[model samples]
Target: MKILLHNLTRFGDLLQSQPALAELAGQGHRVAVACLENFAGAAALLPEAEVILPLPGSRFLAGLDGDWRQALAAMDGYVRHVKEVFDPDAAVNLTPALAARLLARRLCGEAVRGFSLDAHGFRHESSLWAAFLEASSAARGLSPFNVVDLFRKAAGVGLGPGRFALRRPEAPALEAARLALADRAPEGAAGYVGFQLGASATARQWPPDAFARLGEGLWQGLGVLPVLLGGPGEKALAAAYRETCRAPSADLVGATDLPALAATLCHLKLLVTNDTGTLHLAAGLGLPSLSIFLATAQPFDTGPYREGCLCLEPDMPCHPCPFGLPCPIGHACRRAIGPDTVLGAATTFLAGGGFPAGGYPGARAWLSGFDRAGFMDMTSLSGHGETARAVWLRLSRRVLRQFLDEEPLAPAGQERFALPAAVHDPLAEQLAQSADLLRLLAGHAGLAGRNPAMKDRFLATWERIRGLWTASPQLGAVGRLWQRDAQRAEPDLPSLIARIERYAALVAAFADRLTRR
Candidate 1:
């Protein structure tokens, strides 16, 4: 089969999709990748792709010089050219943007999977996993799967045990990187450790002074030379690190391009970074990484995809905060994690002593590993007891995964997820109410099959149920799961009733478990 994989997102997101691309190609599919032109250079890392279609996104925007018609023409012509060239048997759109959706529909018509548009220009999700991705985004902090696993499921591929090996840099680039590192470091240093000094968002970035402290600690204690890495845009951050730390270090922030950066990463003993593209890049190169996730960044959702990587996040409740919103508490999450804590973790990691057993006061640490089902999972090293929110999120993941995988719901364990009475009562009531609505909808559907007049009542009841899920955050994922199942069971009363019953059972199970707690 010929597959056109579409990803027009950031550098990190594009890199995350490489495993799925590799799986498709390994399965004997002729894979072609369509990505934005600016990120076309990164596409070289995805060697599984037989063809690279770099969409001229900037050129299209530039053509929009107050004339919408010209931009539209250019976009249409480009889409046509892509369709004619690849003519894929199917297209999997990993991007959720409007432009990418429309382009997928134009290129593959109904043969497109993931997000796309119907004939009437209405949004359509061609898979349950895609709907889960959309719904999970609306209710943050609830997702238990990494974005990489979700992307693979969306593209109808199985999760791999490890990340795909990215294309290595040329010999010249490798030699240049090695020479550059040797020139910067002192003679007979232990090894080089990379420091990714920048992130996509300011809130997500660790303080430069903190990085400097950590770097100095590593240099003095472990004899490892710190090598700074980031895109040219992070020159200011590199300068900040230089200003604060008087220790011997190499600053390659604005020096290396993508390939050179990869080459440099290949030489590193380990990388200490914020949540950034460089971390993902290091993961692809099989480099050990210790990542700090702050503000809107959380390890559970977007951590490095490889095993044994360490991740740290603030233990505050407001962590993994909503995007585009200013921090109300003056960015306390950033200050919560101190440089000493990171230094200790890094030292332990480098020494192969594993993470410390005790918890940090205001921070938590996790080690990345694959779960039994082959999905990326983070095991807490902080040794703290699970909170009610953590238990709820874990259970939600288990139930949803079981249902989606068509496995039986595992029996409830003796452990309790103790929520305060005030919070527990309302949530239990909502689950019970949702279950009742599902039963009613199922009965109405069964009756409507014989009596045409009952159809209106069934529709009205469904609208009310939709309103229920919309208003309740706990039911958001359940609603998405049911929506996908319901769509597949259309016009078949028996199948529809069975699906409704199964959905009702799911909701009732939640209610039952809540009452048991």
Candidate 2:
């Protein structure tokens, strides 16, 4: 059977979706993927796709300041091209964009999944697709499955441990990358550690100063060479790091293309990078990597796909928003994971060193690739059109309304919202934290998806808060009780809820202050 998959998302998303693409091909089915021209380079590295259909870059269909007829007409041509030449027995639109939905409807395929337009041309997603995509959003702290599994489930394929299969890097590019590295740092050619200084979002990118400190520490302490890598967007950050870094380092950012980049990653001893496409590539290549997950980057969702790979993320309420929401107080999550923590992680990976564990406050370390059963899985993350804050806001508002014993806005005569009421502030960050604790407690009690990581997160968080809430007796007592219950082999649900409500009431009191009477 010929299966067509259209992945019109960004580069990292394209890289993460490869496991399923490889799976369909490995099953002896003819597989074709509609690749965006921009990501055609990454798409070329896929292991087994019988056909690759190139779609024009996003620039082609971008709306003009005035008339958009010309662009619309051109888009119709691309749609016609796909329908005429290589339509498949099955099609799946991996992206949730409206344009992709409309195009999926136009494509000639008998069984189409994922985002599509129905008979009425309204956007639609399969129940499985909806659930899978939702797994990556703000409620990820509550989600039991990884995104790579979600992708397989969305495609109607059997799920288990996933693998990322990639074609070998082009020999020429591989050699070219080696030569470039040699020219930059002749003493330690392939023994260097590459730093990816850029992520798709600035929110997710670790601060340049932290990388500079880490690079210096790696060179000064571990006798390891530091090599930097990124696209054009990272040039400024790369330059900043180069200026501040005291140790000898090579700034290879923007110098290598995707093929050469892949080639170079093979030579490196390890990569310490932001949560980006390159991180996924390194994982696919079986490279030992340390990925930093800061603001809006969730480690559990898109952490490395292999064991022995490490991840560093701040244990803050706002660290893992799907959209990379801006921090009001600045990038606290990125700043919290200082150079010392990264240095410790790097040294442990390199010079056979035992670094101090979990010394840094507000930061946590995670080893990727293993599930509860100890199998390698290619984990990925996805988001519905909602943020974590959005979910929390709704939940907070609904529960708060229930507490108030009346709906704030109800039909009064002809007006639906005639009543004057204060818009209830969800106090999302507070609510999200409450939710995280509850989730952890549930996992620890074996009531929810119990796992090692869940316990680690719960313990780490419990320890952090146990001290800070000393002033608030009610909150502190409830939290201590919750922690005490979590340590038990079997936790009592009724007792847990009583304590949970004690903590919830405290948070609700703050929300109550913000709520207009």
Candidate 3:
């Protein structure tokens, strides 16, 4: 089978897809990687590929700033490029950009098949690609969905648990990478641990100081040689780690392309990353890894398929938190999983011959059922006058919305106004509690406004309780899990509706006070 893999997302996303594509190649299927211009450099890694076609100006056109007409021309150019070169049994588009979607729609027709991991609609790009694939009859399922699961569903071939046997850098490149770093790697079976510090953005990265601390521990406690790897973009970051660390480690950032990085990674014992593409790359190579998760992003869906890979993240309500914006609470997900926790697991794996315990023990502490009424009980705390004030604020807003047919939701700021003090005054107490509740509601909505009238009252109620206001045009912007189940009947209709109405009243009264002020 000849497979044409179209990936136009960021470099890391394309790198992540390598494992799934490698799985197809391992089956002796002929695979051709069709990538945007920027990622064509990655072709050197997939020696198993029958051909590597770099779409001329494809990346630029993908980012073309013109109207739909100009965009379609670029898409047409890609379609023509794919048609003239060769035909594959299938095309898997990993990019969700409009142009990529349009291209996939034209080339693959319906019935496109590939990985679709954007469970939450927050990632508009991936969702667009998955949507296009779905339109092409190619959608296997929701992506970051599960690479292993996707491969099984799409090709009728189970890549099994762990990273799919996707493409890696060619054997020669792998050898060269290893040879180049021979001086830096640890001797014997203890194996070298790869530390990747570069990410597409600062928001995705935990502080570089954190990586340095972990590296220092790995060297002292476990005797693991830490090879800090990243793309050209990560050189400064990796170099910074090397400078600050008390321990000596290899710095390979800005040194290698995706294939070269994959080759170097093939030699590693285990890789530790902060939810970057390298995590997926290491998994594809069947390397053990640990991923540190932050914000609203959960590893349950996007974590490596490899059983051995450790996912260290906290269960914070704010997590996989909104990208770009710093977490108000300082990103508990990454903060909670300290270096000691990760180092302990990595040390154990190195000592035990390359395998860590099944998941982090701390993670189990935050399980949903475990905290059944913790949230409710906390809300019921009668003593916290601050809580009362928050409630009042929420009630005032709800009442105002009802009165004026207006939404009082506002954009979040580092510091929101709270009652001067949590006092015994009923108005003050209500104001504080409502403010907090309204803030909570805004987070649930993920937009800046309230929900418009809906056919199902349950959804409307959900809007009240879970809505997170991002500000501006009032429209339903679903979060990850909600987006998946929005169409389904409310799981517990009566209870959900009750919560909405109750919250609405609280917000209404709270808004009344604020308006008078």
Worst 10 residues of 1 by lDDT: 480-489
Instruction: Give the worst 10-residue stretch by lDDT in candidate 3.
Output: 368-377
How high is each candidate's TM-score? 0.91, 0.69, 0.59
lDDT of 1 by residue, 237-326 (tens): 999999999678999988998888999999998999999988998998889899999987888888999888989999887877876777
Residue-level lDDT of model 3, residues 147-169, one tens digit each, is 33333333333324323455656
For candidate 2, the 10 contiguous residues with the lowest summed lDDT are: 411-420
Candidate with the larger TM-score of 1 and 3: 1
Q: Say which candidate scores most in TM-score.
A: 1
Tens-digit lDDT string for candidate 2 (152-205): 656655344578767778788788888888888847433799899998778788
Sort by TM-score, best first: what order?
1, 2, 3
| Local distance difference test, each candidate | 0.82, 0.64, 0.54
Pairs of residues at least 3 apart in sequence or in different chains that clash in candidate 1: none
Quote the positional error of residue 467 for candidate 3 in Å: 8.6
